[model samples]
Target chain A: MTAKLAERPAGADLVRSGIRAQAANSSFAFVVRAAAVSVFVILVLIVVTMTREAWPAFWHSGLGFVTGTDWSPSADLYGALPFVYGTMVSSLMALVLALPVSIGIALFINEYAPRRLRAPGVYLVDLLAAIPSVVYGLWGVLVLGPFLLPYVQKVADTIGTWPVFSAVFGGPVGLKSMFLAALILTIMIVPIITSITREVFDTVPADQKAAAVALGATRWEMVRGAVFPHSRNGMVAAVLLGLGRAMGETIAVALVIGSTAQITTRIFAPADSMAAVIANTFGESSGVNRAALIGLGVVLFAMTIVVNMAGQFVARRSGRKGAGT
Target chain B: MTVPAALHVPPTEAPPTALATEGLGVYYGDWLAVDDITLQVPRHHITAFIGPSGCGKSTLLRCFNRMNDLIAGARVVGRVTYGDVDLYDDRIDPVQVRRRIGMVFQRPNPFPKSVYDNVAYGLRVHAMTEDLDDRVEDALRRAALWDDVKGALKKSALALSGGQQQRLCIARTIAVEPDIVLMDEPCSALDPIATGRIEDLMQELRRDYTILIVTHNMQQAARASDYAAFLTTEVDGDGDRRRGKLVEFAATNELFTHPQDPRTENYITGRFG
Candidate 1:
């Protein structure tokens, strides 16, 4: 067998096969490289084309396009501040509302749940993410909005009595309101955040967890000592992804956000976000109006990019400080 | 010749028992990992459990601090006692049990925290924060890691070398001033020089703390421990399942030199695992 193996390939034959293998390897490398570069190419194309389409509105309104409040297309007025305000308020509120609940659910599943219940709990939370955003909009309009109206009004009446608190809470409660839209956005983003946090929690080394327990830590203490510091960056990323999801949500916000181009401190008041405004007016919009809608899209894109970059910076900095290299 | 001269000289008197287990059988689901283990661990002495892989030596070591309680579906059907307290009593908190009986893992499992934090973790958790700096320093000093790490207390524990990390883990475990320290193959992941350092440290630590260690290295068990238990796997009836059984427990020198059981003799002679 040794003699046969040694004679299987002569030097000349080995050289030919090596040449063929090298050719195949380079071709495979070329294919994968092309596939990888295509994503960047597509991203650049989208940015260039979108910027070109929105140029007219940028030229027309200049700085006022972002900082000014009015957004009346018929009067040839288009200030994006109202939509920007609505988007920021709704998305940030959603993030604040969803974060704790998502972390709680993740911890419950990963650390506290019984072995039999853990799998089902994860599946159920993931199932929430699988639901269509339109369904969430429908639920917000038909069920959640009406259900929350009384509580929201009670807050407006009670908390609104304080001069400082009255600014954000004092307003007539409506079926289609910023608060209702934000509540729906909260529900929409929770599953994504929870799933990501769960994955991060899983990445914590088992031995590290064992070390904590061996040191006489209670269950919660172990999580705080070992799991939290280890998964800090990942949890930050999860929250940021949820924020991005809440910000770009169109149909859900459009349906429940009251579609009004106005900025108000009262969350119970009707308002419009950037994506909602674009979706609600895009059908009949033409000329400068269409350019203005696309301009809103450009602004939304920039905001998300900035938010993601900020999240990355926070994640990296905290990871270094907390994780200790 | 590497065996210390003191190790060959048996103690003049019997030491008091610090911990004891009776009819101990550990199970994961239905599979019994270790069965009928009854032994008394002497106070302030290093007792080593020597066995091959799958011999449940590590499982038995975990039972000391109730670290097995963390594993899902893992059950202990026996009595483990520290002093007069039944460790498995319903009212006894596993967390508090762990505070009194600490553990070091096979791999050096230091928290992803600064060296200062890693040593202070157990103290902080148990609300023993008074003179925290002194306690951390003392623990590091006891683990023989103070000189190497004192300059880098704020540095991440992970930045240390493998031996330093293991010593740091030792410092973390002893920081709470646990009465007993359980080591599960603490030197298995280390190199020879690091292993020798740990073995020397173990000898120093045995002066104050009761220690139970599970080790695959026979020479380490012989050189470092005062008492030794030799365990081996036995095939269960009507199945291919192998369950760990203790064949002999005796003074370390006696067990290595004149093993009572044929199985122990076989294992010590390198005849079979």
Candidate 2:
């Protein structure tokens, strides 16, 4: 037994195995680090490639590309202001129209709905999101647009007489118009906003809600006092996410926005969005026009990043505040 | 310390009853959580409910202001009355009942709002907005949080310490001038010093509000409460599940020094829960 123990490897063998274990650990770390770094690498690559593709348009239009409104392709005037305005107005309007309805739906599902109905209600809302954007666009153009055109026209004629309303509701209501595009966008984003808002509302601590209720707050008052204040940042984040979705929606807005390049205050008038313009004109464009479309894509990408970053900031701040409490 | 046998005689005059439950039983769906319990909460006194875990002490406390109604399947049998009014009556609005009878929870759940706003929330909800500043200050003072937070009224209540937040909750509850304040393990989440501070505040609050507190700590019940009720879990007939039943109810000193039931004695002596 003593001879066998002397022949067996000592510290040298243990050191060799330890070195092997360290190599294995280092290789595992390297794999995970590569995976984590790849996300940043891919994001940077996309930005660089898109910017390079858009360089010619930037050189051709200079600063006037963003500031100028005209977009006559034959004349080489590729001003993107109209598309930007249409995108902003349509997306913001959709958000304005959708936010209240989404909040109401969320509160109804989470707070007021019967226990048995809540799951079905949530599933139905989620199912709305499952419908394709193209289908929504097709429905918007074929069905809702035509159905609402006459009523919209009538409203424009009557309420359009008011000074402030004239700018918004004015003139000839087209079958495919900004209003139709915005309405479609509203429907598309509602489910996203409602689901997120519902999740945020669910994060409100039960004890805080009880505190409010125990203090004689009516159901509505409890919502206003406890639920609303606690969920403010989360709700903002949800709305911003919905805004990002609305702004980037391509095929749907392209189908219903009539591919017009003009800027108008009238919701009934045909207009074009950044995403819609790219989708519509990309097929036949070349040289600077194509680059200008890609430039628009870059701009939309930047806008989405900004909105999403703001959302992340708010969410993180709320998370920290929640943890502190 | 031994007391004379003659001095142990029960007082003939009982304090006026502020709230009472008659043959009250609480059920969550098919499960009986708390069996039939009948007890009176005397006016302007602190009553503590002591029991082991899963004894439905919290459930019984929630029954006072109808907070149990907020739970999906929670049901209460029999009557809970405040003064002459039945709290569960169809004509009685639970919201109104809550205004008259408020509650503090186990964890200090201050709204993520300004300290002033937290206190003012109740006052604003009840439309008692007149002298809002004074009323808020008065409540904060009553809850023993005024000096600590007076200068920071605009700060978020969440930024306050745990003890301070619980005091803010107490201030918020009493700002509406509720007749009874129900607390469900209000200090169970606090450190010993924080717990002591709350106990001191409770003694001060007992002059105006009839406070009902549920505590797992028998020592807390002995030290802080004027009257005490002991609860224990008992197996239901032919069932494996246990439901909470009241074992003893009496003056705090009497209940601690001389328990009427063997279960209460065993529990107080730390023999078995």
DockQ of each: 0.74, 0.60
lDDT of 2 by residue, A37-93 (tens): 999999999999999999999999999889999998899998999999999999999
Clashing pairs in 1: none
Docking class of 2: medium
In candidate 2, position A35 carries an lDDT of 100
Best by TM-score: 1
Candidate 2 local Cα displacement, residue A261, angstroms: 1.4
Instruction: Output the worst ten-in-a-row residue range by lDDT, candidate 1 chain A.
Output: A316-325
Which tens-of-lDDT digit does each residue in B118-180 have in candidate 1?
999889898999999999999999999999988999999988999999999999999999999
lDDT of 2 at B92: 91
Error of 2 at B187 (Å): 1.7
Candidate 2 per-residue lDDT, tens place, B1-273, comes to 332221222345789999999999999999998999999988888898998998999999999999999998999998998999888899999999999999999999999889999999999999999999999999999999999999999988888899999999999999999989999999988999999999999989988999999999877887888888999999889789889999889988888888889888888888785
Count of backbone clashes, every candidate in sequence: 0, 0
Interface RMSD of each: 1.2, 2.8
Model 2 scores a C-alpha lDDT of 0.91
